[model samples]
Structures are given as structure tokens and as C-alpha cells.
Target chain A: MLLLRIASTHVRNRLRQTIVSTLGVALGVGFSVAMASLMEGSQRDFMTTLIEAIPHVEILDEKRNPAEQPATALYDAVAFHGLRPLEDLRGIRNPTEAIASLREWIDGDFAQRLSGQSVLRYSGQDIGMTLVGVVPGRELKVSKIREDMRAGSFEALDATANGLVIGRKAAERLGAELGDTVTLTSANGIAKRFKIVGLFHTGITTSDEGLAYAPLKAVQILLEKPDIINSISVRLADINDATRIAARAERQLGYKAVSWEEANEGLMEAFVVRNAIMYTVVGAILVVAGFGIFNIVSTIVHEKARDIAILKSLGFPETDIQQIFVLEGLVIGVLGAIAGCGLGFGLSSYLATVKFEVTTDIEMTRLPIHFSYVHYVLACLLALFSSGIAGLIPARKAAKLNPVDIIRGAT
Target chain B: MIAAQPQTGTDTSPLLQTRKLTRILPAVVPVTLVQDVDFSVGTSEFVAITGPSGSGKSSLLYLLGLLDRPTSGEVLIEGCGTADLSSAEMASMRLAKIGFVFQFHFLLPEFTALENIMIPMQKLGRLSAHAQLEHATGLLVDLGLEDFLHRRPAQLSGGQRQRVAVARALANSPDLILADEPTGSLDSAATEQVFESLQAIVETQKTTVVAVTHDMDLAGRMQRRVHLVDGRIDYDRVQS
Candidate 1:
């Protein structure tokens, strides 16, 4: 209570100086909060872009081990795993059969679920139409695959017949669309005709401009490598747990598993570096606010020498005096934190509403500012704690004063 | 020459006693500001110590008031040795039993006259806030400062401020009141009024008063007067 009285007196006596100091602290907190919000928004945007570009996890072939030797390697390995090796692998005597076995497993167990699935057989000309060999209802889970369907409905691949799905960019390049027949030349120099059933446009440059889809069997037949697949993609229930799930999948399926982080390490690293730089800049602002608190509190102590002596003579303990100055600093910190929080949220919301044109080819043209509650709380706490620490020096000095000398005008 | 006659039928207990009190001034060669001072004030007695400037009269008063510790010897207030008391205890003792009135009227400038008087009582921590206020107001009225209770020290005249200081000194009903030239800063008329208030309080409350002063006339008017020279008692006398 006595501390409150002293703090009240301090503020009343030095209202102007206190206000200016508080504003300094508030600006520091405000700047930090704003920077944190911006960093958080940028990271969210980066993650969204990456997730849209690829499946959360991709399964690939494991490397062959040179130490292991077996007779009739491909056929024996595939038969041991209850799978059918592709015809191309059957011709190679003693070839590694693990890849063929993986292809057989996917064709037997997942083929019914692989809707809108595709394959593209390109010649040396760098142009080809999509051979989309999908089940009737399952390929929408792929990244950017469902969102790109612009023309005819997605195609279903029959066991014996071939169909194709091409993107708008490919249509523009080959003068083909739904119901147009296009010839696909494979790497083995085989020419096959496929009817384009759908044409889609995904905004992503890499996918929409070059991608083609067809059934796995049709692509294998066109490429003259029956029962072979290039890669297998998987989407999980929990996107964040993709890394752990991918590891489990690698152990279960005997194939190499890749997570989103491993696939886009460069992008994630850039986000991390950007966040670190932002925190350093904002932390510097908070440090400046701490210095402002120190300056203001010291000045208040210098000005209140006489008042302190009077209180001391009235038998107020040194701890009481220290608490008074500390409370004054606390008042400044709390008020500044509140003001900064309000200002930061208001500014972030206003900025979120303002349309910002981004000329990037891969993302939305206008980016909206994102706010995180955790970051806001952290910023306010940093400001409050820094101000409290700043008060210590002056509070200790105030506590150590000699009442007699002060009252005697020895100050 | 008047003979020294002791009090008649008074209590033998001394309210304040100092034995060979000394205060040293710090320097390359330390100067003995006040040395070998032996003094005691009995209950209900008013004693005055008179000396010229730089004669160490105020130094002796400060030592006796517990505002400063003596370099040598001891101060016993109400039969308790003060040398052994902790700083906090000494402050408490001063708050409970001793009152001080400085020549400069060291009342807080921000507080009103009533608030200044209420300080010592507040420090005692024995009375409730209401009781402390009541006691303070009663003391102010006794000192004839009721009219100026709301006025700050700066707003009041020199005499009124000093009277407020006296009222504050009497607030806790201290056994001893030490005044170091309490009226030194006031005009002649103001000084007379301040002295009248002090004398009236001392008489009515039977509070022992020990005053250090350069005013011989004021010293002569007290019941007992002691003259200090070069930190030693030169003469001691009592008036009829």
C-alpha cells in the first residue's frame, strides 16, 4: 500500500516524463508484435505453397545391395513376395526384383483406389499427351490434381483400353483436348495412340504446363515395360505426422520414403532464416525499450530524492522504497504492453484486409496478413519482463539512500 | 550566585541520560566536535543547553536524539542502553519515546500540517489510522495549530511550521522532546509564539524538554540551563 502511494506520487509528480517513457516502451512492443505477425504469416504462406505442390509423402525404390547375389534374381524375388515382375524385368536374367515386386504390390492392392492416376510417355521431342489410367473415383487426394480439373470429367481406365488426360499447357502445345487422339512415342521407339479424355489447368507452373496423366497399366504398355511404375505417392490422415508415418511406411513396404521436409528442405530452411532475422530485429526494439525504462526510472529517482527522505524519516523500510520504484516501472510496463497489444492487433488486422499484389508465378496474387495468438502473448511478456528488469538498477539505488543525508540536503 | 536545588518530591528515574558523549568530525586529523559530555534530564523537567556557533551544541543534541550515534560513550533513554539497539530498533525507540524539532523545521513540504504531525504516530504502528489521526489533531489543537492543520509547511508561516513540528514531536506522547534551536528560523514575534507553544505543551503534558540553543534569553527562561563550551560543560544553573 505504501509502495502504491509512493508510485502514485512519482507519477503525479513526473507525469510528462512518465508518459514519454511509456510511449517508448509501447512502440518497442508494437514493432516486435508486428514483425512477429509478419514472420508467422510468411511461414504459413510458404508451407501452404509447398504442400500444394506435392504429396505429403512419396515412396521410392530402395538402392540395390552389391553384396547380395541370387540366381533368377528378378523373378525369384518377385515370386517370393507374392508379386508379378514386369515383362521387361523377366527378360533380364538375375536382375534385381525388388522394384518389380513393389510395382506388383501397388497394382494388386492400390490400383482400385488410384483414381485420376496418370502416366506420360514422352519422346525426345519433350512433348507428350497425358495417359490417365485411373480407377473411377480415387485420385483427387493428389496435390493440385483435383483442383486442376477444368474441362471434361476425369477418366476411368479399363483393363484393356487406354485413355489420357492432358493439362491446358499440353493442349496448347499439341493442339489436343478432350476426345482428340494423340500419338505418344515412348523411350523404346514404340508409337501408340491415346484419346484425350480430360484437360485441366493447375496454376502451378511445373504441374499444369508439363504434366500428363494415364492409367499405370497403359503407361507401362506404351513404354513397353508392363507392370512397372515410376513412383508411388501417399496422403495420410495427419499431415503433420507425415515424417513419422513415412518412416513406418518405408519399413513396411521395403521402399524409401520421403517426407515434405526432405522434399522441400531448401524452402523450409529459407523460412527459418527469415524468421531468425526478424526475431533479432524485433528483439533489438525491445532492448531499446528496456533502456528507455532504465532512463525514466533513474530520472524519477533523481527527482524524488527529497520525497524519499521524507518517507524514510517516517520509518519506511528500504524494501518499501525499492518496491515503490519497481511498482512505478511495472505500471509503465503493463500499460505499454496493453497499448502495444491493441495497436499490433489493430494494425495486423488492417494490413490483412489490404490487398497486396504479389507477382510470383506459383502463389496467390494477394497475400493476407496472418496473426498468431501465441506470438502476441510472447511479445507482450517480453516487453513487460524487459521493463521490470530495467527498473532494478534505479530501485536498488533508491533503496540504498541514507535518510539523514537526504533530509539534510546532502544530495 | 544561585544554588542548585534538585526537584522536590519528583521521581528519581531519569527520562534521558548520556555518559561522556562525543562526536568526531572526519578529516585528516579528526576533530572532536563534542567530547566528554555528561547530561541527564529527569521526568517533567525542561533543560536547555546554550552555546555560541560551532560550539557543538547541536551535535550533542543529535547524539542524544539518536539521530546520530556518539563516537564514544553511550546514550541511555528511559534506562535502556541505546548503543546496543539495531538500526530498526533505534528508529522504533525514537518513534515511540523521543521527539526532535530542528532549527529549520524539517516538516515535509508536500504534506499538510496535520499530516506532518501524524508521521511519528503512524511510525509507532500501535494506533489505528483513525486513532492516529485523532491523536494528531488533538496534538495540533494543543499546540494552537488547529486553524492551519490543512496548510502545507510552505503555506504556513515559519512560526506555524515550527509549532506543527512541535505538535508532531508530541504526537506519540514521547517521554523526551529534543529541540535544536527550534525557533532559530523564526522572527522575534514568531519565535515568541513558538516558544509559548512549546512551554505550554511541556507544562501540560509534563513532557521532559531538552533544547539546544544560542538564544541566551530563551535559555534563561527554561527551568534549568547548561552552557557548553568547546564540547564541555562550562556552567550549569537553575532559575527560580
Candidate 2:
């Protein structure tokens, strides 16, 4: 109740300074929220694009040696049971051992593969291709790999041996197409011919230009690396459980299991750095606004020294007097945070609809703005807290004043 | 030096009592401003402390008013020692029992006359909003400031502002009213008017009044006058 009266008195007495201080804080908060929204939106968009283009998890060698492939223990366990490594198993050991293990394990004395997903690998000349020996029906689980198919059906793998799906850029570079014969030269210098039954284009420039898909057995025979695979890819029931499942797969397979974030560390780091820089810039604006609030409050305390003395002589406690100024700051802070939130939301949404032309070496296009609610809330809280903290110094000084000295002017 | 005996006819406890009230001016040698002064005011008595400039008349009033603690003495209000009270308790006691009027008419410039009067009562936290408003209005009316209740101090004349301050001082109906040269800054006519109002409140409410004044005419009209010379009481007299 005392705070309410103090707040009222503060508003009544320092109207102009209060308004200006609130505006300063609002500007700070608005800038912070808008920048945060843009940063968060950009990050979310980057992650979404990357995730849509690749598997959420990918297995790689744990050795940290680029030359070493992922271990085949889990892959072999799934294959030895006559089960496809990617489809049926939660994880796999050696590619062929997985097939044999699935058959034995299902007879009941041991844990069986979760499902029957296939894994196959093939190498062409010094250029190795990870032949994702996928089941025809469940191939869409691999994401844009299926979406990018420009011709022929994913079912083409079920009907024909030595059939291949070549990327659009790869086909263009190799002068190959649907139903055209392409010779794949293996790592051992063994050459084999395969019919390109499909064409695909992954929108991402790098992958569309390089990746190729083939049936498991055909590639294995062609490369003469039968019952062997470089790695296995498994689709989890809960996509968000990817990290935990990857850890479990690592422990079971004695091989490295990687989440999409690990697979694209460079992109993730770029996103994180971009967010940090944006927040730092926005934070500088808030710091400047906080200083503005501090200055205004200090001046108010100086100007009202006599008035404060009178109130204190009337038996107002130091805490009560301090509360008045603190309340003044809170009023300014709350008003500013609220105003900033409104302005930031409106501005961010407006910007989200605006398409700005951006030019880069790869392509030039207009991109629409984007915003996030979490960033808006964070900015409001930061502004309010900073303004409140800024009020503290002046409030303490005001509280410590000698009422008699202030009233008598040095007597 | 004959010691004065405590009068038994009055209430056993005085409304305000100061023993050896002293104040030291901050200086190289710490000049003694007022010292070894014993003073007491009974309920319903109007006492005046009169002295020349630098005689410590205001310092004496301040000590009795509980606005400032004495350098080496004790102020007892209604038999309770003030030195032992915590800051909060002292404030509460002041709010409940002491009213102060300074020469400058220190009414808050931003608040209306009525709001200024409402301050002490608000501090006491004893009055409801409607009651506080009513009591403030009553005090303003009693002080002949009903018309000026809504006016800010800046909008008022020096006499009017002092009247409002007096009204505010009496708002909580304190047991003792202390005025330090309350009319010192006012013209002669304004001074007379302020004095008349103070006298009227004391006569009707039976409130103890202790005023520090250089105006001998004003001091002579009080029930008792104590003249101070060099921090000690030179003459203490009571008049019929």
C-alpha cells in the first residue's frame, strides 16, 4: 500500500523524466526482442532445412581417424539373423552378421533386431559410395532421399538387380540417365555396369551433385565386398529420442553414433555464433538504456532532496522513501517492457511479412523475415531487470540522506 | 544556583522533559552551542524558549521535539526515554505524539495543503482513507485554510503555508506541538495571525506547546517563558 502511494506520487511529480526513461528502456527492449527473434528464426530455419535434407542420426567411426570406417559389430549382428540392418534392428554389428544374428535371435534365446531394414555398401574406383540397401516400402524414412526422386519409382530396387538412382547433377556430369548404362569402377579397380533406373535432385547443391543410391546385393557383388557395409542408418520410433538411441547404439555396436548436430558441426557452430553476436549487439543497446535510466533517476533524487527531507521529518521511514523511488523505477520498467513487447511483436511480425533481397555468390533471392516468441519474452525480461537494477544506486543514495541537513540546507 | 523543584500540582509525568540538553557545533574545537539545560513542559501548558541569535533556542526546541537527539542528554516523552527507542519506534512515537513546525513552512511543494496535513496521520497508519480525508479537512477548516486546502504550497502566501504546516502538525492530534520560530519568516501581520491560530489550538485542544522565538512579544504572551544565555537558562518565569 505504501508502495502504491509512492508510485502514485512519483508519477505525479516526475512525469516527463518518467516518460523519457520508459521510452529509453522500451527502445532497448524492442531492439533486443526484434534482433533475438531474427536470430532465433534464422537458427530454427537453418536446423529445419538441414534436418529435412538428411537423417537425424548417422553412424560414423569412433576412432576419430578419418580413414577408419565405423565398426561393423552391431551391423553384423542384425545381418547374421537374415534381417536388414536399417529396417528391423534398433542397431547393428557387422552387416552380414546382423542378417545371420536376426534369424537366430528371433528363435528366442537372444534379443532380435527391431525390424528388417537393409544395409549395403559398394565402392566405385577410388570413389566410395555407401550403398544404402533400403527396403523398397520403407525408403521414405530416409527423408529427401525419396522426395528428390525425379524419375522411376523407389520400388525399382525391389524388382531389378544392378539398378541405380543417380543424383541429377551426377547424371548430368556423367552423361547418364534413366535406363542408361554406367560403369562403376571399384576401389580394387574392378569395373561393373549398372542401369540408372532413377534420377534424383536434393535441392542442396552439394549432395545432389555427389550422392547415388543402389540395391544392396548388386553393389556388394559388383564391388566384391559382399556381406560388408561401411555403416548402418536406423530410423527411431521417436525422432526426438535420437540422441539417447544413438548412445545406446554406440554402446551395443562398439562404434560411433552421431546425431545430426554432430554430423553438421560447422553449420551448428555458425548458427550459435550468429545468435551470440546478435544478442551481444542487442545487449549493448540495453546497457545504454540502463545508463539512461540511472542518470534520470539520479537527477530526480538530487532535485527532490528537500522534498525527501520533509517527508522523512514527517516520520516516513527510510525504507518507505526508498520504496517510492524504487517504485518509480518499477513503474517505468513495467511500462517500458510492456510497450517494448508490443512494439517488438508488431515490428517482428511486419518484418516477417517483408521480403528483403539478399545476394550471395551461390544465388540471389528475396527472403522473408521471421520471428520467435521465446526471444520476445527474453528481451522484455532483460529490459525490466536492467532498468530495476539501474534504479538501485539512486534509491540507496536517496534513502541514506540526512533529513535534518536536507531540510535546513547544511545546518 | 537554587535548584528548581518539580511541581506536584501538575500530572506527575510531564508531556515533554529534557535533562541537560546539549548540542555541539561541528568545528575545530567543537564549539558548545547549548549545554546543561533542563526543561520540561506539562500537559496543556504553552511554554516559550526565547534567546538571541546563536543562543541555541532552536537547538533546544529540536531536542524537545525529538527531531534531533541531544549530544549528551536524555529526552523523555511521557516518561519514556527517547534514547533507547529504535529508529522505527522513534518515528512512530513522533508520529503519534510530536508535531513540528519550522520557520520555513516546510510543506511539500507538490502536494496540496490537505495532503500535507494528511502526512502524519498516514504515517501512523491508524486512519481509514475516508477518515483521514475528513480529519485533514477538519484541521484545514480549524486553521482557517478550508479554501486553500487544494492549493499547493507554492501557490500559497508565506502566512498561508505556515498555517497549513501548523494544521498538518496538529493533524494526528499529537500530545506536544513544537514550533521553532514558526512565524520568523512571516510579516508582522502574518506573524500575529499564525500566533493567534497556535494559541487558539492550544486553548481549545489542551495541547502542550513549546515554541522557540526571538520575538519577545510572542514569548511574553505564553504561559511561561525561559530565556537562555550561552546555552544555560538565565531566567525562567511563569505568568498568570
Candidate 3:
């Protein structure tokens, strides 16, 4: 109780310095919290877009390693790497059995795909593009492409014969509209005419200008690769369980299964680096505020030398003297943190309401400000930790002061 | 009052005793502040340490109060040797047994007169907060500071501040009050008021007072006077 009284008295004595130091901490915490929200808000926005645009897990007809030779498996041979083997067909052999088995155990939906490059011919203009053959019903469950359609519908692939859904930009380049017949040549020189059933604009320039979707049987017949699927895309109920389920599916199906995190490994690593930079900026801010606390606390210790001597003579221990000054620093830190939380709230709210002068089709117009109480808690903790360290340096100096020397000098 | 007082000496054990108490300031010349001094004060004795400027008078009182460690000697408190005690133990003993008054009022300027007196009692923690409040108020009232209960040191007069210091010194009812020129800066009228306050404490409260002073009249007023010259005892005699 006496310690608190002494601490408050010391802080109240230097009113202007206390306020300045407190304002420094307040600004540090406030900006850090707002910056944290901005950084994390955009991360969440990008992640949501990424998770919706791609499959959570994809099983592809690929090999992680060369198949074990018959001799090596049977005889434990070490130096028989030169053995030649026959090349097998490069696609999942029987997707029906695998898909049925996956459906019995998996919690979400799946989409079968056979994607290949093709050239579109219309008005004597040739535009190269990727054509993905998909089951219209299953593709709708696995992806959000249906929402990007400008005209027609993704389900029309099943409704019309020889139907195709191409990006609106790709169609515009060919002067082809919905219901227009466009001749497409496969990579192997096979050509077929497909009627445009839908048009989509995904806002991404590359996808909008160079992608199209068609019926599975039609593409298989055009590519002359019937009864073969190159990929099975799975969308799980709980996205976080994608990696584990991918591993399980790879083992059970003997296919190379990849999770979304593995597919976007570079983007995930970039997020980590960005987060590190954000926290360092926040910590630097708090450290600067800590220097403010250090300056004011050192001043208080210097000014209270006589009071310290008197307290020592009055039977206060060195620890008590140290505690008084340290508590004075904490008083400023706590008050600043509370005020900073209010400032952070105001700043975040303002950012949330702000809009951009240049608007995009799919990108957000206003600032994405993620509001989480964790940001306030983390900012407050950082302030306290920095202020604690700031207080300790001068508190040690005050504790070491010899009462006799101070009293003698002052008298 | 709780423990058996040490019986290291005669039946009438001196309240404070020093044997060969020397303090030397380590410097280029190794100046000796106090040298090989043997001193003792009996219980409830109002003593004066008289000497010229820089004669180590305040140095001796600091050594007795455990505020400064001696160079190569020991001080005894109630027949118990204090030389071997750690800094923490020394501070604990000083907190419970010794009080101090300096030439400057030395009250924490931030604290009121009542809070200033309550500091020692609060440190000792012998009484509840309520009782400490009552005791502090009583000490101030006895010092005739009843009218300035909440006045800070900056608000009080020089004489009133010194009396508040006296009240603070007597807060823990210590065995001895080590005063270094307590009234050195007070006016003649204020000096008399503090002088009577110290006398009332010594006689009525039975608390021993050992003051370092240059005022010959104040020295003469004390019951015993120990005069020092060049850090050595010149005379020790009772003043009639």
C-alpha cells in the first residue's frame, strides 16, 4: 500500500513528463494495433479468395519416385538402378473406384478433371487457351467459378450438346458470343466445333483471356484419351485437415496427392515473412516508446535523490525505493495502453469506412480492417514489457545510490 | 520488548556502544573521517556531539544509526554486536530501533505532514493501518501541527516542517534519534521550538537523542556533551 502511494506521488509530482511519456506509449500501441489489423485483414482476405479459387486437396496421376524394380524388391539389390521398364499410361487408370472409395470416407465433395491446351478458330483468328474437361455437377461443388459467369451458366455444359464455357475475354478476342459455334483444335491435331454455352469474367487477366471449360466426354473424345482423368480435386469440410487427408488419400490410392498449402507453398512463406516484418515494426515502435519511458524515469530518479535518502533513513529498504520508481513507469504504461486501445479502435474504424479512388471488379473497394480483441491484448502486452524494461534500468541506478552521499551532498 | 536483550556487558547495558569505531574515505589521500573512537550512551540520555566544521561529528552519529559502515570497528546495539550483520539486517535493525532528523526538513515534499510521520510506522508494520493513522495524527498534534494535518512539506513553515520531522523520527518509538544539526537552518525562534520538542521527546517519551551541532548553546543544553577535535575525542563530560 505504501509502495503504491509512494509510486503515485512520485508520478504525480512530474505531471508533464508523465503525460509525454504516456503519450509516446499510447501512440506506439495505437499504431501497432492498427497496422496489425491491416496486415492480418488483407491476409485473411487473400486466404479466403485462395481457398475458394482452388481445391483444398488434389490427387494427380504422377509419381513421387520411380517404381521399385522387381529384382530390387525381391532380392534387396543395391546396384541395379540401370534396369529399364515399360512406360505406363499417364493418367489415373480407374477413377470410378477411387472416387467411390473417397466418397465413402471423405467429408466433402470431389471434381474429376482432364485439362489440356487447345487453339480456338473463329473469324480466321487463332487464340491459344487451356480447356478443362469437368463434370458440371461435381465442378460446381468444388469451385466458385459459377459465381464469375457473365452470361449463360456452368450447368449448361450438361444441358446442351457439345457445349463450352469460355471466359468473356477469350470470347471477345475471337468475336464469339454465347450460342456461337467455335472450332477448337486439340494438341494432337484433332479438331471439333463446340457451341459456346456460357461466358465468364474472373477479373484476373490471365484466366479471363486464356481459359475455357467443356463437357468431360466431349474433351476425352476430342483429345482421343477416353476413360482417363489426370486429376481429382477434393474440397474438404474442414480445410485445416487437408494435409492429413491428402497424405491418407495418397497412401490409400497410390496417387501423388497435394494439399492446397503445398500448392501455394511460396505464397504461404511470403505471408510468414510479411508477418515477421509487421511484428518487428510493432516492436520497434514499442521500443521507441520505451525510450521515452526511460528518459522520464531517469529524470524522476535524478530529481528524487533527496526523497530517496529520506526514505532510506526512514527505514525503507533499497527494494522499496526501486519499486517506487518502477511502479511510476508502469503507471504511465498502463494508462497509455488503455488510451491506445481507444485510439486503435478509432483508427481501425476509420480505415474500415475508407474507400479507394480506383475500384476493381473483384478486389475490395474499402480497406479490409480485421477487428480482433487479440490485437489489443498483444499491443498492451508489448507496451507493458517494454515499459517494464525501461523502468528497471533507472530503478537499479536509484537503488544503488548511497544515502549518506546523497544526503551529505544535498545538505 | 519481545526478545531477551543481549547480556554481553554489565548489568546496565549501554543503549549504544562503539569500540574503536573508525571510518575512512578511500581516495588519493585516504582521508580518515573518524578514527579509533570509543563512545557509549546510556538509555534516555540527551547527548550532544560538538566539534568544529568537518570534525566527523555527523559521521559518528551516522555510524551509530547504521547509516554508514565503519572502516574497521564495530557498534553495539543493546549489548549486541552490529559489525557482522548484513546490509539487510542492518537496515531492519535501523528501521525498528533508530530514527533520524537532518538539518534540512528532509520530509518527502510530495507527502503531507501526517503521511510523512506515517512512513516509518508503515515501514515497521507494527500497527494496523488504522492504528498507524491514529498514532501519526497524535504525534503531529503533540508537535502542535494539528492545524496543518494535510499540509505538505512545501506548504508548511520551516519550524513546522522540522517539528513534522521530529514527529516522523518518533513514529516507531525508536531507542535513539540520530539528529545531524536538526535545527541548523531554523531561525532563533524556530530553533527554540525544535529544542523544546527534542527535550520533551527525551524526557517524556524516554527516547535517547544524540545530536551533532555547532550551536554551543544547544550543546550546553544537552545533559552530556562529547567534544571532538580533528576526528578524536577531546572531552567527554556531563553538563550541569
Candidate 4:
């Protein structure tokens, strides 16, 4: 109690220096928290876009490396190692069985899909496109295509024969619009004329410019592949269950089922790297604030030499003296942390309110910031720990001061 | 009557004693601050240590107060040798039995007069907070500082601040009070007032006093005087 009282008294006596030290710690915390909020908000935004725009789990046709064959050519042994082409591969062949099995094992929305590369011609403008056929009602449950549709409706595309739902960017490039007929030709010189029933925008340049959707029956007739499907898109109740369900589906259905996590590995890795850099930058700020605390505490010890001697002469042990300064440091740390958290919350909220234009499939008009108490708790702990250590160094110095030396000097 | 005699209470033991006590400041060139000095302070006796500047008068008082360690000799309080005691043990001994008052009136500038007096009691931790306040106020009132009990050192007069220091020294009610020029910074009138206050407390509390001062007149008023010259005792005189 006496040590705490003494420490507080010292802080009160030197108000300016105490405020400076407190602000030093506060600025560090505020910057760290603000940076964390921004980084976390952006990460959340990117992940939400990824998870909603793509299927949580997708079963695709598998291609593999062909078995190598050894041959003798001109007295030298040669090995041929090449990959098998997926064009010759057929569909899963038993689509009903695979779909039934997935439905039985996992609680999710499932849709059959057929995709191939083709070229679209509209008003003399040619664009290479990936043609996908989907059952609109089922596809809506697995992906955000329906939500991103800007004109007409998925039902119109699903009901009308030879109707194509085109990306908005592709329509813009080719001068195509709803109810306009476009020409689509397969690689084998087979062609068909389809009317654009709907246009969708996904905020992705490649997808918007080069993707089109048609009714499943029409695509099947055009490709000359009836009762066949290339893959199934699945959306689970919990996205985190994507990996488990995907592995189960792959093992039972005899196809490669890729989870969103696996599909976005590169993007996830980039986020990890970004977080590492952000934390390091924030941690450096906290450490700098710690140095500020150390400097102020050390100066206090240096200036209070006579007061220290007087206390020491009063039979206050060295340990008590050490505790006094350490307590001082802790006080500054906790106070700074609280203040910084307040500042960070206000700044983040204010940032969230400032509208900014970001390209998104959904209507978005502001920078996203996720408010989390976990960040504040961690920031407080870090600030306290750093400043506590800072206080210890100078506290030890003060404890080791020689009362006789100080008294003699003062006299 | 406070008369000085040679080992008055008991010939076999004195209240505080130092035998061949020597202190050297070790450095590139070692400086001997106090060399081969012998001294004793009996119960209820007031002794003055007087010498020129840098003659180690303060050094000798520091050794007696257990604030510093002797290089070669041993200091014994109540015949218990302090050479083997740990620093913590010596601190306890000082807290329980010895009190120190410096000439600069080294009251903590941030604390009030009563709170400054409460510091020693607080450190000892034997009294409750409420009781500590009562005792601190009582000490200040005894020293004629009741009206200025809540005043900080800066707000007090020179004599009032010195009186607060004396009150602080007596806070633990120790057996002996060590003053390194208690009135050195005071004017003549203030010096007499502080000296008289100290003399009254010693008489009333039966506390032994060992004060270091340069004023010969002040030294003459003590029951005995130990005069040092060049870190050695030049004279030990008693006024009977």
C-alpha cells in the first residue's frame, strides 16, 4: 500500500512526464488496434466474397499422369512420362447414384453441372467463353449467382429453351442484351443460336467477361451428351464442414471433390503472410512504446535519488522500492491500454461510417470493419506485459541505489 | 540532569559500540574515510561528532546508524555484532532500533507533514492505518506542528520542516536517533528552536542521540563530544 501510494504520488507530482509516458503507450495501442481492425475487416470481406461466390464443395472430373513406358531408341533407354488428356474422359456416368449418395451422407444443397469452352458471337464481336448449364433453382442454393443477377431472372433462363444467361461484362463487350439472340459454336463445328434471358455481375473481370449459363437440358442436347453430367456443386450448412464432406463425397462417389479451402489455398496463404506483416508492424509499435516507458521510468529513478535515499533510510527494504516503480509502470500500462482501445473503437467505427466504393457482387458502399473484443483483450495484455518489463529494468536500478552514497551527496 | 559519565549504566556493556571501525572507499586510488576509530554511545546520552569538512564525521555517523558497512572493524548494537548480519537483517535492526534525520530535512516533498511522519510507521507495518495516522499526528503535535500537520514541506517554514523531519525520525520510537547536522541549513533562531525541540524529545523519550555538526556551540550543549581529525578521534570529552 505504501509503495503504491508513493508511486501514485510521484506520478501526480510529475504530471507532464506521466502524461507523456501514458500517451506514448496509448498511441502504440491505438495504432496497433486500428491496423488490426482494418486488416481483419478486409480479410473478412475477402473471405465472405470467396465463400459466397463459389461452392463450398465441388466434385470435378479427375485427370492423372499416365503410366510411364520404357523403350530402347538408338541403344539408349528412354522413358515417356506425360499427362492424360481430360477431353477423352466421360462424365461420372452414374450421376443419379453419386447425387443420391451425397444427399444421403451430407445435409447440403447439390446441383448437377456441365461445363465446356466455347465461343460466342454477337453483333460481329467474338468472345471466348466457358459455357455452364445449371438447374437454376438448385444452383441458387449452392452459389451466389442468383443474388448477383442484374437483369431478368434465373427462372426465365431455366424455363426458356435455348436461353443463355450471360455475364454483364461479356454482354457489354459483345453488345449483347436481354432478349437478344447470340451464336454459340462448339469446337467440333456444332453451333446453336440462343437468346440471352438474364445478365449477372459477379465483380470478377474474368467471370463477368467470359462466362455464360444455359438450361441443363439445352446444354445437354447441344453437347450431344444426354443423361450425363460433369460435376456436382454442393453447399453445406457450415462452410467449415466443406473439407470433411468433400473427402467423404470423394471416397464414396469415386470423383475428386475439392473443398473451398483447398481451391483457395493460394489466397489463404497470401492472407496469412499479410497478417504476419501486420502483427509484426503493430508489435513493433508496442515495443517502441515500451521503450518510452523505460526511458521515463529510468529518468524518474535518476531524479528521485534523494527521495529514494530518504525512504531507504526509513527502513523501507530494497524490494519495496522495486515494487513501487514496477507498480508505477503497470499503472501506466493498464491506463494506456484502456484509452487506446477506446480510441481504436471510435476510429474503426468512424472508418466504417465513411462510404467507399469497392467492387462487390452484393450492394456494398462502405469499408467493412468487424468489431471484436478479442482484439482489445489481446492488445491490453501485450501492452501490460511490455510495459511491465520496461518498468522492471529501471525498478531494479532504483532498488540497487546506495542510500549512503545519496545521503552523502545530498549533504 | 543529563550529565556525561564513562559507562554509567553498566561497565560491561554500552547501548551502542564500535571497535576499531574503519571505512575505506575503494577505487583506483582508495580513500580512507574513517580509519581505526573507536566510539560508544550509552543509554540516554547525547553525543556530538564534530570535524572539518571531508573529515569523515558523517561517515562515522553512517556506520553507527547501520546505513553503511565498515571495511575492517565491527559495529555492535546492544553488544550484538553487526558484521555477520545480512543487509535485510541490518535493515530490520535499523527499523526496530535506530532512526536517522538528515540536515536537509529530507521529508518527501510530495507528502504532507503528518504523512511524512507516517512513512516509518507504514514501513514497519506494525500499526493499522488508522492507528498510524493517529500516532503520526501525535508525533507532530508533540513537536509543536499540529497546525501544519497537513502542510507539505514547501508550504512550511524552515524550522517547521526540520521539526517534521525530527518527528519522522521519532516515528518508530527507536532507541537512538542519528542526526547528520539536523540544524545545518537553518538560521540561528531556527537552529536553536530545532535543537531545543530535539533536546526535549531526547529527555522525555530517554532516547540516545548521536548528531554530526560543525557548530561548536551546538556541540558544547551535548552531554559529550567526540572530535575527529583526519578520520581519527582527536578528543573524546565529557561535560559533567
Whose DockQ is greatest here?
Answer: 3
Instruction: Count residue pairs with overlapping backbones in model 3.
Output: 0
lDDT for residue B121 in candidate 4, whole number 0-100: 90
Give the C-alpha miss distance for residue B191 in model 3, angstroms. 0.6
What does DockQ give for each predicted structure?
0.23, 0.48, 0.73, 0.65
Off by over 4 Å in 3: A68-84, A357-364, B1-11
TM-score of chain B of 3: 0.95
Q: For each candidate, what is chain B's TM-score? A: 0.92, 0.93, 0.95, 0.93
The candidate with the higher TM-score, 1 or 4, is: 4
Please give the TM-score that candidate 2 achieves against the real structure: 0.82
Question: lDDT per prediction?
Answer: 0.71, 0.72, 0.90, 0.86
Interface RMSD of 2: 2.0
Error of 4 at B87 (Å): 3.3
DockQ value of candidate 3: 0.73
Compose the digit string of candidate 2's lDDT tens values, residues A183-251.
665555666667778888766665566556667666666556555555555544456766776676566
Ranking by TM-score: 3, 4, 2, 1
What's the residue-level lDDT of A317 in candidate 2?
A: 71
Q: Give the candidates in order of lDDT, highest first.
A: 3, 4, 2, 1
Candidate 1 per-residue lDDT, tens place, A57-78, comes to 7765443232232434645545
lDDT of 2 by residue, B27-108 (tens): 8889777898887778888889998887878777767766676677777787667776666677677778888888899887
> Model 3 residue B131 lDDT?
98
